[model samples]
Target: VTGSPGAVITLDTTAGVVFQLNPQTFPALDMAGADDIHLRNLSGSEFSTSVNLVADITTLADGVTPIGNNKYFNLVIWGGQNRTGQTSHLYCNLPIGQYGKQGDAIVDAEKFSVHTIPNDFRGVGFLIGELTFQFSSGGGGTWALIQERVLLGHFPILIPGGGTTTIISTFVDSSFEIFGNLDDTKRIAFQADSITTGTTRIITMADVNVDLADIATNNAKVSNVTHTGDVTGATALTLDLNNLGTETSIASGDFLAMVDITDSGSEKITFDNLQANIVKTGALNSGSITSGFGNIDIGSSTIDAGTIDGTAVTATTQLVSNIWKDINALDVKAEYTGSQTGHADFDGTDDSVSIADREEYDGTGVF
Candidate 1:
């Protein structure tokens, strides 16, 4: 059952309802790409960012109130899959959550993550299996699940891909394993000969990965911040990039965030330039700029602290962005005809470094 734009879906157990899906017409095999079930909620209240499919669900947040608003779930590869003796996972893409802002409309907790399948059953075939789910509130606790029988499918359509920065994220139970050779499951990928939005093809590496055993928060360009798991941090997958555009620097404070990680609080990677020409605002404020560290009320002198080690800065957490890291290995070579004017003004100042957030692997984990 898929709820389209302006559609409403409700689950009232008292109504004697059992949701059904189109059966697979192909051979029955575990994890085989056969028939799939799709359930989406374009407008269903009662649902929150997280849903617990372990119980009647009526007692968990939404009660019996509708719960799925702009949410979705997919039961893929529904056929002779022997998942009876194991557990499969379904990640939650509560992009806006119940707290998401639709166009200009606002709702508190409408994006329900946990969806009720009416009964503990799914698909139509001789190998149809039982389905169950649980909810997660990323604000705290464990929602990142891992090291088990998992079916990673049904990605959320909430990712805004039009702009320069495309955002896509999902929440899972604690200790979720992202890297490993799969056995009973296969990560089915959708291939696009020429993927484009409106009339333009996507191009560019916007941010860092969130689930690389580095932290739990979505990487919005962090360096070495440490966060051990949910509520604290997140892990991320590898970045899949190609033909992305290029960004260059050749002026003073041209790249904001050069040394200051403004989003994750006031975590600054400062640099001390003997020449006291300091900048205090904009993107190159912390890491991007090679010299300017932004000008602020620094004691009695608005000086240029542009030489301090600016390496300890970590990434800021984002809700709907997935984590993918850059590939940096020895012997990797590259070249670019950077614009002569594409650099931040050095102002003839030698810079010093000030690393922030104790390196994630430092002997002592202290910021």
Candidate 2:
């Protein structure tokens, strides 16, 4: 008989009742992914789904609720039904008992890593507090043939004062071992610690990897400093010393040197006596002189053979030596003038001639 919404169903035992157990598809539970689930009573008063559940859920019913939120009596949890075990793939919310209220079961004393499956019966078997387990038939009748089968079971655990325990199992207790992939495995390990005065003790994993881009923090100012790295592709760099007090000089061992110009069109170092410094250097690589300038000072400077490219060149010693050598080569002899002015006759011209007489006979021959 199908347990559909309008289907007839019956209750077992001597005190029988004919009614449905609300088989209207209790929405499936979700796997706990990076979260934890807290168990509480059926009133939904002190329950927390965070840090406990990993997926979206439908009904968070406590299987042990005795028709109401009565802590004294025991409760029953009829196995949820699904054709292909679709509804039972997620974990159940077990009660987290207090220190004094927790039972002697091993799973209750410590944190349990729970595994869930799609099957109605999970491989997990644990006892907490006063909760008990019982099996049922799909037809609402007694299935005595499968009574010896251990569908779910729990054992006692002796835990240390402060330690951790890991629980690893499949979702349902079944003889089938179809899951061979390690991705579907679940291990829920929990650690216990002692709390300080005002601080609550909790377990934390070290070395957490996080996406720093998601964090919103202060924008820090980075200082100007040289960073050391591999010297493979670094070709050029510039440095500005405008804020420095005095002139900075590069030391001998310093190989890399560069200067950055000011952005306001101002020169870094403006030399006033640029021409004077050029004169002191004596030789210019390639330069031109100013038009209508003073004398060219090639004085006592031994220029290279093919260095001078100008047309005219004159100097003190050069003028004196040339004039004296020409005058000394002239041959002069004695000569007589009109009355008695004895004169010396040069090789071709008169050596002695009166200043006034020479001017008077300028148009004619020499007198």
Candidate 3:
């Protein structure tokens, strides 16, 4: 026992003997029931009364086992701060394993409770409840149980449309940005007006189908070009070599032709005016040409027909031959018709030039 001002008391045990203290003793007054008792045997041994004492005694049962495996030490405390902020009440030094067992060890629980008049504690967020359980063997450490659980009030719910029980979320002015990659399989979709819940949405596109059955038709040109559908009463189509160069080849189906090709690569083939058509014209001129071999190859001349003209001469052939060879072996078919009597250097530079090579000189002209 301990008294104020450095006065220490002792307890002695004798065989077959018991000792007790009364409230009406020396230097002690008004002490009764276990409420106003204090012990001060501060020696660092098992005799220290501070070892198993607690703020509340309800945790320790009146009759309980002292020590063993699977022991129990439960502490149910009400109205304490969870000071650590981990929970909503107060708890400290909580042992891991023995935190929630019933009493069966050296020490018991420290329990307390608070009762409020609801009006006196209107707005104060006070401590609510705490429970702890702990246990241990004959080690120097005595584990403790600590826990705290809290409760709160309910909020008001606003209903919309009076039919569907929809879950409405109210955010206090918050925005977020999500970024990631998208591929053919994955996509994004729209959900409601402001709410979305899926991981992603997919958008799709397809070929556009046109309905031309109602529109007026246009006159299509067809000739040197092949017409697949209908070109009934249409203007003649022509493939202009305009701006096209030599050494180029044009092909369709199996027919391939190359014409008007040059070595300097300066002069290009010219098709002044070309009418539109589905038919393709493969000129030895500028079109599509593959190098290393012949200038052009018109796959099948039986299908595509046209006169192959060149600078030196003109040749008419059903099949397309070598581009340069045909131009060199051109046959003069346009005969001289004007009368000067004799022939002149086939004045090719002049309009009176004849298809023949012989020319006449002097006023009478040389034959």
By summed lDDT, the worst window of 10 consecutive residues in model 3 runs over: 154-163
Candidate 2 segments exceeding 4 Å error: 1-116, 121-219, 227-256, 262-367
- What local lDDT does model 1 show for residue 191? 34
- In order, the Cα lDDT scores of the candidates are 0.26, 0.28, 0.28
Candidate 3 per-residue lDDT, tens place, 186-251, comes to 432223444466633444554776553424442233234432443233334333654433333334
Sequence-dependent TM-score of model 1: 0.15
**Stretches of candidate 1 above 4 Å error?**
1-68, 75-367
What tens digits encode model 2's per-residue C-alpha lDDT throughout 103-141? 212223323222222232332322222222121223432
Clashes of each: 81, 20, 41
Off by over 4 Å in 3: 1-367
Model 1, span 1-367: residue lDDT tens = 1111112211111111112352222322221122222222223432222222211222223233332433222211122222343322221222222211221111111222332322333442221221222223332211221111122232223212111122335322121223226541333222344447466345576597544545445554664354332232333223223333334434673434234333354333333333343334323444343336564333764335444332222333211112111212111112123332121111112332232222122121111
Candidate that beats the other on TM-score, 1 or 3, i.e. the better one? 3
